[model samples]
Target: MKPIVAIGDVHGLEKWRSIVDEHEDCTIVFLGDYLDPYEYITRRQQLDNLRDIIELKKRRMDDVVLLLGNHDLHYFCDRALPGSRYDFQIERFAEAMFNANIELFQYAYQQGNRIFTHAGIQHSWFVDDFKGDLTQPIAHQLNNPESIQFNAMLRLGHARGGRIGKIGGIFWADISELTDPLHGYTQIVGHNRVDDITERCGYNDNKIIFCDCLRNGKYYYEE
Candidate 1:
């Protein structure tokens, strides 16, 4: 199995640097929320940082998998209306990010006969849902350019169940652990801000790891 280093959420550049330095050689899983509500970076600086990170990931071959959290999709859409409710200083940069045709989400490794997804997959979808290898199913169903465009159309608010309840919400879609126990593979997620890791046990025993991030100046998960 490849050594996997999944960073929880990067709201601060310093914390991101720490994770990168600590897990340099491991396959890096950046568990989204790369935008919004961080005082460490100016809105413009945030865009530059995002671009640099994306570039670094490409340079490092396929070592990095960027899984989109709710916040990322919000930023992606905020590019359209600069003064919208969720719009921030990064709006201009959003255009650049979009025009570059960068991807917002990714899946990690499938190892030891089990696959890994960023958010938990619904009971409706899994590796067995595919007719061919895993990649083919993902590309045909969710990861295609047209599919991404469709998924990106709905705003985070609309995607939330509270506003208009449904199982198809992006949060519910990616954060798959909360909905069902993945019977076939281990599904990992990072969105529910738990004080510590939350684990669930069931017939299939799906494991959900809600990793911690930096709060204030302290690294929450560093030990």
Candidate 2:
């Protein structure tokens, strides 16, 4: 993989499919949220999308990294669910995916020096939890990926029956409140909806880039 393409929330799978062809010389890091079908999408269709992605991961384990978002974590932990979602159904579908690709659905992926996750890391939590560091701590946690800790940092959030604004976990962060408290690498994330991919300077040499425009139909191709 030459250049890495970090994708935003997969409300369904259109965004994911749209960027597949762009993977010729690049690794694809899919930020999760694979369930909760959009208004026009059906549950079966959503599962099919997920199934295809899971299969892709199986085929190209090294080339594809599937990081969990709040929704994915909801099914993984089966608690603190953000209202009544398809937790049970998604769990059933994800069981096969997770079992076959256990190491794939980690909390975050660090490509080069940049960190990619479903939601951006909370500025404060990165300091508190990870001891004011980004890449190393995230990589270490992903090594184990246990349920309790992953849930606290990943799934506990706004629409998922948790508080709206706080320095939560990687998957639970609200990007708007994120600050760059670390140095070195940039953090690329999904979850928060934006019109286009935007980059902002952080406290140190770090950057925070938002990659959630697919929800609004604003793609990299559009630019």
Query: Which of the numbered candidates is closest to the native, going by highest lDDT?
Result: 2
lDDT of 1 by residue, 108-218 (tens): 334443334434444433332322234343323444334344443232332343244333322334343245644544545555554555556556655445553444222
Candidate 2 lDDT, 1-223, residue by residue in tens: 3567777878776767767776545687787788775566877888788888888888878878888777775664645345235656566766566566666677777756677877776555665654443545565565455565555565454543457554666766666567663366677888877889888787667787888877765432210
Off by over 4 Å in 2: 83-91, 130-137, 142-152, 155-165, 216-223
lDDT of all predictions, in order shown? 0.50, 0.67
Q: Locate the minimum summed-lDDT window of 10 residues in model 1.
A: 214-223
**Which of the numbered candidates is closest to the native, going by highest TM-score?**
2
TM-score of each: 0.68, 0.81
Name the 10 consecutive residues with the lowest summed lDDT in model 2: 214-223
Shift of residue 37 alpha carbon in model 2, Å: 2.4
